[model samples]
Target: MRRPQATPARVIVFGAGATGARVVRMLAESPEVGRVEVRDPDTARLRRTVDSCDDSVTAARGLEMPPDADMVVIATPTGTQAAAARAAVNAGASAVTTSSEISETRELLALGSLAAENGVALVVGAGFMPGLTCLLARAGAAEFDLVDEIHVAKAGTGGPACARQHHRALSSLAIDWRDGSWTRRSGGSGRELCWFPDPVAGRDCYRGALSDALLLVPAFEGVERVTARLAATRRDRLTAPLPMMRRPHPEGGVGAVRVELRGRRAARRHVAVLGAQARPAQGAAIVAAATALHLIGRADVSGAGGLASIRDTGRLLRAVADRGLRPCRFEGFTLSRDETPRP
Candidate 1:
């Protein structure tokens, strides 16, 4: 368990756009973080972001070498984050990011390792789905004698503004481990899809979005069956989130994480509905809160930087428990009276 050092803290936030704006706001409210450096190339935008912060936050263009920064969070686009992380690692700084769990190509392994070897941890996929979702999966794995399988499901009508900005890195992708080699296929895998029961729509299931499935499943050495599903609810005026975008959501959207565990005693499972239709902002806030806990060393983090699996799903869920979310059990085709999925 890492402990907060002291106040007058300093953090460097890359891309002070919307997500950066929210992150900066969260840090400002924290008594532990007193100073923040928001970095972006746009002088006008950076100035606006900095002005929004109390005297504590300073916005600047061209990120200087992080000489005295305490924590470095890279919320920039994926293509840019790898380079930014390398720079941070070279500067001997700790980093937290929601950047698409290290790309499936293992491209940034060496750069990320540099941070670890330097003793500065770089956390990846620290956002809602992969970040907290993975954390919960880790926790569920803890309860079972053997985590014979792990399934991750998440569907969003749209991503937060910050996510949309980094669409190249954020959109769904097909990935899973097989025979020791990680493989990438199309997003819509040809698996026989079963309907995940729903009240409004009823049994809607397609190839689950493959965002985290490709990056996380392999992390749990023994787990064989891992599914990452992505679904969306739209107003008919809009279409599915494209395979790419350049900004996080301006409004917001809802999503959920469900983990199915096959235990020896009795098949047990835990389902958490986070980020719902009615309150997308709250959903993003829930994820942000979980990320903050991990950032401040308040909870344990599992897996390396590429992508985050909260590893302690129970713990992560607990962190966001205040979001008015709860766990419900499910049977084959029917959800018990008490087992309604809020999202």
Candidate 2:
């Protein structure tokens, strides 16, 4: 008797814009992915994405998830993510979403019981900042005895949709987790100087209506303080309240995410900082692709949650690094014994 070969995975991606197209290309390259289909309402954009990929990939104009799809990766606009995710679960396919919008993330999380009942996994915020930043926080938290505060900051946007979201994030109200309570503040009010990895170094960041805290809080138990910020320019802040004046570039340039973990270790204070740099679209694609693969390949993963819900952070981070989004750690700082506080 001859041994049987395992079947390859079938993945459907919704949206063929910058991040979606890149996701399709990356999924097509994986040997585990047998068939890749990309769907977009825009025919021109769909055709361009399919034309750019290899022969194994196909294009469709419909947004519905096919029943045969093993996994559905959604890179559509933030507003449409919830509906698409529900469709994916209804079709009995695992789903991954790259949405960073707080409201959208909450909507997706609300589908947890539905997804769990159907035995499908729904991974939310599987993009650059919330995605990778979530992973970094989880990994860094493991190094400390007690994690007290987690601050995440990101610099840059990916495609036009991302740019628009970045603008809107600044204009919306910001949410922060402080001392066992949630507080709302003006998006651009809390200005802080943040240092990202090189190439995207030292940019002024401000509190934003980002989804990091919402996703991270549930994953880490008893963490006191959690805050998220986005890099912004003086012009960016001034123009945030108004509609975009001009068309955004087809794709933005280099982007980065910095995760800082503060806690105690062996009766002493310890801090760990990790960061990664890549084009926003590229980084998001890498993280999303890795997440889809992991979700599809594993039988143990189920339920709907953010990247912080991932059971194996090391495995996912290693896969992401393998795909070229290697995370870098910052070192060379010593804690002073008398630096606790001054009365």
Candidate 3:
């Protein structure tokens, strides 16, 4: 495990939406976290979010990043993530954000020099799919000598914000990395059967969003193909054009993320799967905390660089376990050519 740091005595969280509130709660609940300030234009929400946590939390106004904050978490809309992250790094605070598509990540990457100049790390995609998926892909990639393809699939029930984001994403084109470049397709295209754990067994998932693939392609060396899919429900499929009206799933939030890597390890065809299960918010908070803690620990490291999530696979998994996610909840298995049945 990476050494815990006392440097992030305080944290500043931007936005007071569903994910932001959860992030604040997770940080405030931590004994090591000193102070947590939540900012939002909605005064009532900011107050409610701050009040929900312990005395360590306070409500703040505006999007300004706190200079004293050791780390800043941007949980605002996907569109605003780049700007928020830029502000956080400029304010001299190491930062992480849950929202950022491939394009937005490019904008965030452009700020790498600024973050470096300020002597801080700026990490994007610190939430569940993009964050955890990125970490998991990297982890799975490490076990193989050469990677040929990568696929990630997720199933979960998210809140209103998540629903809206889903609606928006599905209403548009989803892209994936193939043949060394991005390939765009309809939101619900590329249907395939995906299996999760017990609760969410075999179900039809489609290539819903390509953001994870985008992050993986660059982060995972020598990957030719990267694909990410979202579990598609009947309602989700029908409501693709009108996402705002989509009905919520009746089941209590149970979700899973599985990463599959096909590569050569020891001169044999190797296939691997790495996965985890939790509520969307819970998973998001776990990755968010892990990213924040990582930056906090590296506060004094010189040279600024922007990466998606915790780069160290072992450290990332360890951090995930430390933050209430049991190792059993996250599963990994590998299969070799000799064990495979040829068609």
Candidate 4:
């Protein structure tokens, strides 16, 4: 006798923007997903997204999620994600959010108990920086005996909404976790030179109102310092306080994230660095899609949390790499025999 095939998952994505469209396409390609629906207020955008995907994909006009959906991917703008997530969980569907905003991430984390009660998972910060960065941090931390500090930096933006959010983030107050306390600093004030993967190499990064620390601190129990920064230009810092002078491009250029971990390994100070480069929207979409698939396959994952809370970082990273967002690790040059120092 042959075994019966399991029912495919029904996934609903909110937003027909760059990331949302990409997520729909990815999910449509997955054999595990049976139906994919995209919802957005903009009818034209919604139609375009649905038309771009496979025939199994459909378009919905509003924010409401159907109760039958197995998963809901919230690719909407930052402020709008929490509500969609709430509705999805209440309707008994697992939820995934790409939101990178601090406040919004906090709001989503608060849904942990609700999601657990409903026996559904809520994965927050499933986008590029907070998503991939968190995974890299966990991967690096695993090599350390005691991680003391984690610093994450990113370059470039995704869609227009992402560009706008980056602008606002530079103007808002930046938060840092230090010495078991939170510290606030003016955004764009602490500029530091950061080296990313090729094509986005060596840019000036500054403290920003990013949510990486919120996601990472909880995952790593004894980590004392955590900070996140964004690559910015002199003009970006100068103009951050003012309204955007022009409409952001429909999509930005190559974006990258660099994660650096400092800790003690074998009683000696050690550092591990990992990074990846891609179009921000594409990277975000890949992470979100991979996360949704992981959630679908794993019945053991239930509750709301960021990528840091994920049980299997290695597996998720491998899946993301398999999807083409390959991560690069920084391995310092080894000493030659001739160059070895005598004790």
Candidate 1's residue-wise lDDT over 54-162, tens digit each?
9988876565655877677766544577676667767766666655443522544445557656666666665555555565566555555455455555444233443
Report how far off residue 149 is in candidate 2 (Å). Answer: 0.7
Prediction-by-prediction clash tally: 29, 0, 1, 0
Between candidates 1 and 2, which one is better according to lDDT? 2
Against the hidden true structure, what lDDT does model 4 obtain? 0.90
**Model 1 weakest 10-residue run by lDDT:** 271-280
lDDT of candidate 4 over 144-223, digit per residue (tens): 88888999999999999999999999999889999999999899988889889998999999999999999989999999
Q: After superposition, how far is residue 250 of candidate 4 from its true place, in Å?
A: 0.4
Clashes of 4: 0
TM-score of each model, paired residue for residue: 0.72, 0.95, 0.88, 0.95
Q: Write the per-residue lDDT of candidate 2 for residues 250-321, one digit (tens) a residue.
A: 999999999999887777778899999999999999999999988776667779888887778788899999
Off by over 4 Å in 1: 1-4, 101-105, 157-173, 190-211, 232-249, 263-303, 306-317, 322-343
Q: What's the lDDT of the predicted structure labeled candidate 3?
A: 0.73
Window of ten residues with lowest summed lDDT in model 2: 334-343
- Model 4 ranges off by over 4 Å: 1-5, 333-343
Greater TM-score among 1 and 3 belongs to: 3
